[model samples]
Each structure stands twice: as structure tokens, then as C-alpha cells.
Target: MMRASVLLISCVLAVAGCSREPAAPEAPAAVQADPAAVAAELDALLAEWHESELKANPIFATALGDLRYNDQLPDMFSASYRAEQEARERDFLARVQGLDRNALSGQHRLSYDIFIADRESSLAGNRFPAWMLPVNQFGNYGSFMAQLGSGQGLQPFKEVRHYDDFLARIARFPVLNDSAIANMREGIAAGVVQPVPVVEKAIPQFGAHAVDDVEQSVFWGPIRNMPADFPEAERERLTAAYREAIANTLVPAYAKMRDFLRDEYLPKARTGVGQMHLPDGKAWYAHNVRVNTTTDLTPEEIHQFGLEEVARILAEMNAVREQVGFKGDLPAFFEHLGTDDQFYFKTEEEALQAYRDVQQKINPRLEQLFDIFPKADYEVRPVEAFRAASEAGASYQSPSPDGSRPGVFYLNTHNLRAQPNFLVETLSIHEASPGHHFQISIQQEVESLPAFRRFGGYTAYSEGWALYAESLGKEMGLFTDPYQWYGRLSDEQLRAMRLVVDTGLHYYGWDRQQAIDYMLANSSMAESDVIAEVERYIVIPGQALAYKVGQRVIRELRNEAEAELGEKFDVRAFHRQVLVDGALPMGVLQTKIREWIAAEKAKAGA
Candidate 1:
């Protein structure tokens, strides 16, 4: 799983005259008097918007290797913040409306469209009270705070000021926590509560932060690992300050959040798991589907498509079973695969080593399929124990743009059974190497693109590209073993199952148990793994659907490109065209590729 960008759907870019101008403009025109002037104005607007966004979302800035706002934290769940954001979007739209996007050419025109699309999508989402349903099984802002403060995430602790920056940030956690509770209270009254299981899973996560022993807390990490270069006075003062901050601010705030969830929120949370359970939930889910898939496919269509994919992939898995000489039907073979120790790892170290080994073997082989690579490298690590239980089987965090941080591929070691031995190659290909680390890092490294394009993404394009990369394992001279090929099928089947289960839960009124049962019967996943995945889709609707939806579109485009160009079709060139501009909406990607195919055809005739 790729870590989500905090800036909504795409980058919420703005036309900045609203901030810099003496007065708001009356209305926008379809065309401006000057096209060159509009392009220059847009460059200024994008730069201003980038700085404004980074300042508004300090955590995101820190993650991106920008530290100008390291000492700050926003009250993201507050009503004032909501109003301010809405006004900002309206202001931006108004400003953009004043510009002549059609008059611009090339990337300037594309940027203008994406900027408007993001602002419009964000404005549309304001109808749903997301702030009311902030805390879920996956930690929200409060959890993000803990990740940065732990000194093991994006926040650096090398210098004394780094410690001070954290201290400044942690002091504000109470306000954010109080605002979250306030939002939840309003949500409860408005009937926009999270589901019971989501709250139940979250209750323990909140309590974990308020441990009685401050020294033993995750927040104490930076203090423990304080650099030796610090002056004795600075270190002592920082230690005392951290001790006070953790005991006074963080612990009590967390305890209050824990008590609120356990006593107040849990009782009020709805029993149903679907987003469809809330007011205007169906529309809200449709909005999410549009945001996640970046397409207009309805739930019914996606659900049926998933069913077909499940059957097709199952046939492939059965082919592998035959190759291995297993005497069983598909369902029986699934049971056997889950039960057989040969398919399982003995230790966490062994599983981690398996992923690491794939990295070493595949790194040199990537040249066969691609010509470009990221300047920043990536490392493999176990998922942090605190959040690993609720986390995916594996996830990737992008490296800092300045190369201060290497990308991290976190393999969940919470359950060895969940991390099957056969999955290392396929999973590795998805999370690291030519998957997220490559896509994200390369985008960041491209200095010519706008900051928003460098950092922002469409889920379908990025996730689809990763899944397509998994299919490339065969072309790369890997997946040589039949079981390794089965692993690819297993991963594909998981995405296909998501399309079915996500829609079933949200659109068709399927219960939690029914979704879990669908996954278990359809795939060889362990029950624990199956439950985790179902619950993941429960908390985050429409996200799981991105993988298969994106993969199918990307694969279709590649196939078409191959057919159009024939023997002249260069796989490496096709990949460059897909990846060169960072993530784009699927429709936009299709147009771009078709135009490229036309150009290639013209070149052949000439």
C-alpha cells in the first residue's frame, strides 16, 4: 500500500491573485486578453499554491523534505479550518476561472485542467462530513503525529533544533485531539459516526499512546536517541522539556481521546460497516469511487468485472496447481496451499530475508524492462509493531525529495502466516523496486514538472502501474518458478476480490462476514489475513478497487500501443511515455498514449 497524500485527491492548486490582489475579481472569462501572460501568471499561482499547501500541511512538508514549518501542526478537524479551506478552494476556483486555460498549450493547459478538476472534486466532497468520521481503524491525524514524533518516521532528530521542532509540534497535539473529539461529538449528533468495528479496533491504538511509563512510550524515542553532538546544556534542557511534554501534553491528550472513543464514541458508532450506512452515503461512496478510480464506472459494473477477473485468475492458479502436480480442485487446492507449511515462512527474519533477496536479484534485472531509475534508493524493514496489526501485509513510504530519507518498504511481521513464502517476489515488485518507490521517487526527482505533479497522484494510474509491473516479472526473467507465477495470480486475485467485496459492502449491502467469506473462498489467504483485508476495505471504501481498475486500463493501453506499432513497438519507450508525466487520470493517460501512437505511426510512414 502507498502512503496516502494529505493534499486531497490531486493537489488543490490555486490562482493566487485572491491572496495578493487588492480585491476579489467579479467573475471569470472564457478567454483572457493574453495567452503568454496567462501562462506566466499560472506559474506564479502554482508556486504560491505549493508554498501555501506545504505551510498548511506541515507534516506533509516534512515528509517531502521541506522543514520550514517543522514546528507547526494544524487543527485539521476544526470547524474554522474547514471553513477556511472551503473559502480557499472557492477563491482558487474564482481566480482560475479568470484565466484562459484553452489559450495555453502543452503542459500549461494540462496543469490548468488538473488544477480545476482537483478544486472541483474537493468542493464536491465538502458535502460529506469526513471530519465527523475522522478516527478509524487506520489512525488519522493523531496517529500521524505519533509517527513523526517517534523519530523513526519522516521527522529527523539529528540536530537540537529537530528536537525543539518536535517539542513545539507535540505541544499542539491537545488542540488537535480536542478538535477531533469535538468533530466526533458533532458527527454523533448528525448521525455520521464510524462503524463499530472501526472504533473497536481504534480504541486500543489510542490507549497505546498513553502508556503509564513515559520513558517507555514511543514518543520518548527522539529523547532516547538524541545526538551525541548536542551541548550538555541543550541536551539536558531538551530532555526535561520532552519529559514534561510527553507526560503533560501527549499522554493526557491521548488518554482523553482513548476514554472518549471507549466511553462516548464506541456506544454511538453504527453496527453496519458500509459508508452507505450514513446520510447521503451512497453519493459519498460514488464520490470516493470517482476519486479513487478516477473513472465513472458504477458499482454494479465494477462488481461484475471483478467477478469475471476472479474466475479468469482462478483458472490461471489452477494451471499452476497442475504444473506442481497437486491432485485437487481449485477450492481444495486453496485450502491445501494455506495449510501446507512449505508455502509458509518459519520466522520473521526468514520472511524479511526473502524480500531482501528478491530486491538484490531484481535490481540488476530491471534494466531489461526500463531505462530510468530514481536517484534515491530504498530499504526493507519490518512494519512498526504498534500499527502493524491493522496495517497491510506490506507498504511503501516515499523517500524525501532531497535524498535525506531513503524509501522504506515495510513488510508486516505481525503475522508470519499472513506473509506467505511464495508472495515475496510479486509483493516486492508491487511495493518496492519498479513499484511505488520508483514511481514516486522519479516523479519527485523530475525538476521540470510542477510541484503538484511531482507530489500528487491519481490512485488508478499509480496503483495500476504497480500491478502492471508485477506482470512484467515474467519479461524480466523472474517468476521462473511455477509457484512464483502463482504468486502473481494470487496478488491479482486479491485485487479482483477487492472490486467485488468493496462494492458488495458499500453498494450491495453485504455484511462484514459475507465480505470476509468471499475472500477466503476465492483465495488462499489465511483467515487472519482475509479479515484484515475485509476490515481495510470497510474503513477505506473504494481504495482497494484502484488496483485492478488501474491495472486493466494500463494493460489495455500497452496492448493497444503494441498492436499499433507492431515490431517497432518498444516496451521501454511505452513505459517512459506512461511514467514520464507522473500520475494522470486514466482518461488523460489514454489520450496521451493514443497521441503518442499516432506520432509513432507518422514517423514510420515518413
Candidate 2:
């Protein structure tokens, strides 16, 4: 949710008669705002904004384990609501940019910078009509609700209140879903709509929920998993309420949307797969590039950089191929890795277990890499069946701040071939243990930082860090097997390909198949994985660019640190410095590491 703004409070004494008003107290001498005073004000602004954000999107709040707003689902797509959010963003930018950041230092200064940047980015992005085309194959409110409605998501099913909370939200789903229709209509009038293919992908997903039987709906999951301690009457009563709600409200909502998309939206959906076809698309994609990568690098620069990285990584892959004595070219080696029976699991259980196996392997290796660890634990789970078809290969969900929930690494087992054996260790390291779960758990656990920094993310920093973590596999001695090393290269190749394919789609006007073919030719990825990845870049532009862009900057910083610090360059210390602060923009991150290196060098002289 975009944060709202608050004005500083004013207090004035007014209990005096007009003529008998006491002489004003002597004016204080003019001086800079005290550092602590500025920090307090900035902290106040951030705290209030975070609270407002939670309230604005109650589901977001609920996902973070804040139960106060679980029952509310605001009309986020309505024009009035959008205008109000834009106003709030402008107001926050005014208040935060008004702060005397020069007087502040350390965490306070960083907070001020991040807050101002966030507000500015949000406001700048308001020019783009992202709200119009909200739902896609990837996700939107509809699919997200399914995740929450199911018992497995962050929403608790422990008590009666929880059920009621979800019931209220469910009743409001029609409002939100209809608003999605209204927004798409508005988009249609404006010549802005999701690509034809991605919209078609969402049909079955929403259609799956439009069932006649209330028991069959995902919303019935909590009722099925109800606690044993509940009295029979309460169960019966709650079950009836759920039945009525699901049958009348929720299923009807899904059906309405499924029909609308099939009958209404699809005919009007744009044929061009890239944002460049939209109004002001060039500048719009530029904004995405600037924001996602957190650098001024253009689409062209990122595309070329991706090409370079792909070449470099492929060279290393060829070395691994030769070492393994594979009598084939790199593409042939990629084919072998893709089709060979030894490279894939036979069943979903084996696929999931492969990910689970990585945790045990890395547990002992972590001590060699770093001193810091998150207090919150993480679990490996499969992506739920309903939306898994469109979900990414693997993703990590952060633990609740209250520690009620641990971080989750959701591996998509929709296609077992996509979940290959060789890639297990690399993917696990990227999405689980020292990748997202590790970085995010460390971030949320840092209580001294403001709530926004703890929970908010900069994509380039976080995803870049995760991509960088994949490289650490070799450093930690985990990439012993040549096949595992190839897996690392393959995964890195995916990020590298993203930098190319994302730019090619949005900036170069490449069609969907062109992007897909490019990825297939470049990496050892399954065709299914390649298609999903390409479509992901289509729906969400410039996001894929972040992984390679972020990883490059971070790796450059590390290389520079190792070079300058020499014997003093402890990898553990370097890891601490990077992870200690939550995710930072690539530029801020570079400056930070340089300062760390200078400080460490000063220590050598001292």
C-alpha cells in the first residue's frame, strides 16, 4: 500500500483575554534543528506513514500479522481512491523532503533518504496507469484472495474471530472484483489493457473458483481445517454462514469476473506484449527501469550489460561442461541437462524433497560464511495448486514481525521438469537459506530500524542480493559437483536472460515468442519455465532487469572491497555490512561499502 501523510502537530496557548494576553516569551536564538530532534520528527513521519499504509491495504496488514485491519478491504482501484492516494503521496513527499536531513546521521539519515526516495518514486509512478490493468496471469486481488482464503496462507484460522474477519473480507471481494472490471473498462476506453495471452492465462484460475458447491470453493478451506475444540453448534453455525457467503457472494463474484474477461475484456485486450505499445510507453518503461534497478542505467545499457554477463557465464559453463567431459556444444549441453532423466525428479514428492535436502547441506556451511543469523526460522512448502500454474519457480515469504509465522520458501512443483535436480541447491540457496529467507528475516528482525525499512523493500537490493547469494555457493564449497555448478550457471543465466529479454520486450518491441525463443536459445531452462519467465517480464516490466543489475553492482562493490582491504577483507564482515542495513538502492549500497572499506583501512593504520 502507498503510505499516507501526516502533518506535524501544533499547540498554542489560547486561554488569555485579548487585552490581557501575557507578553510573548523571549524568542530563542536561531540555530539548526537538533540532530535528535530531526530524527524524532523523521521517525514520527515514518511510523505514522507505516500505520496508514497498513490501514490503506488491510490485507497487506493481515499478511504481516497485524490483525487490526483484517476485516477491511478498501476500494483500491476507484478513481477517487487513487486520487486520494496520490494526494497522500504528494503530502508525504512534502513533509519528508521538508525534514532537516543534514543534521541527522547514521540510521536516521538513511531512513530520511529511503522515505524521501519512496515517496518520490511512488509519486513519479502515478503517471503510469498500472491500476487500470491490475489483474493478470501472474496475480491481482482475485488470486491473492484465494491464497488467503485457503487455510495455508498467513491469515490465522485458530479462532472464531478469524473466520468472521475473513467472512467480512470475502463479502467485500465482489466490490473489489467489480472494481477490477470497471478499471478494465476504463482501460479499454483509454487504449490500455493487458496483453491477450496473459489475460487468457487468468481465465481458468478465476473459473476454478466459480463452482456451485460451497464446499468445493477455496474459501471453505478454513472451515474444513477448523479446530477440534470448537463446539458442534459453533461449527454448524459458522459452516452455514460460510456456505451462504461463498454460494451467494464469493462464487458469484468469481463467475462474474470469469465471464467478463472471456466475453468482454479478451476481445479488447492488446496484441502487443510489451508496454512500449502503450501511451508514453518509452518514458513509462524508463521510470520502471530507474525505480526497479535503483540506478540511472537505461534499458539499452541494461540490455547490453546482460549480453556481456550471459557471455561470461556461458564461458564458465563451457568450462564445467568440458570438465564433465560432455561431448557436446554449450547448447547441446543445455539440452542434455534439460532432457536427461537423471536431471529431473519422477514425482512431486521427490521434487519437493530435493529442495528440502538443500537446507541440511547448507546448515553447516553458513558458519563459514557469516556471523549473523535471523531469529525467525523458515520452511519449504509447495506453491498451492490453484495458482501454482502461473506462479514463479520459487519465492520466499517473510515471517510476521510478531514471530507467529516463519518465512516460507514456496517451490512451484507445477512442472517437475521445471524443478530439476541439479538446480535444487542453487535455487534453494537463492530462495531459501541465505537468499531471500535469510536476508528478509534479518531485515524484519532489526527492531532498531523504522518499520518501513524493516518491512519495505527495494527490489534491486533484495533480489540482487538473492542472485548474488547464488554465486556464494561456489565460495562456500557447496558447488562441488559439476552438475550443481552448471545449475548455478543456468540459474544465473535466467537472471542474465531476464535483463536482455525484459529490455527486448519493453524497449525493443520484441514479441512474446521472440523473448521466449531468446531465453530457450540462451539457457538450459525447460520450455515451460522459459514461457512463464517471459510472460512474467511482460506483465511486470523492468523487474527482471533488477536481478542482474543488482547482482552486478553488489559484486563490483565486493570485488573492490576485497581488493582494497586485502588481508583485512573478511567475507563475513563484508556480508555483515551488506545485510546489517536492510535492502538499499544500488547507489546507496556502493557508497556504504566504500565507506566501510575506508573505515576498515583506517583500522589497519591505527
Per-prediction TM-score, please?
A: 0.95, 0.94
lDDT of 2 by residue, 1-606 (tens): 011111110011011111123335546875657888888898899899889889887877987898999888888988888988888888888998787756677878767766766776777788899888978988767888988989898788899888888889888888889899999999999998999999899888899899878888888999999999988988999999999999999899999999999999999999999999999999989888887877778888989988998899889999998999999898998889899999899988888877777888887899898899888887889899889888898887888877789888898999988988988889989887788888888988888989888887878888888989998998788889888888889899888888899999999999999999988888888899888888888998887887887888889999999999998889999999999998777767777888899999999989
> All candidates' lDDT scores?
0.86, 0.84
What clash pairs does model 2 have? Answer: none
Clashes of 2: 0
Identify the runs in model 1 with alpha carbons over 4 angstroms from their true place.
5-33
lDDT, candidate 2, equals 0.84
Name the lDDT value of residue 222 in candidate 1: 90
Candidate 1: C-alpha RMSD after superposition: 4.4
Q: How many pairs collide in each candidate, listed in order? A: 0, 0
Model 1 Cα shift for residue 15 (angstroms)? 20
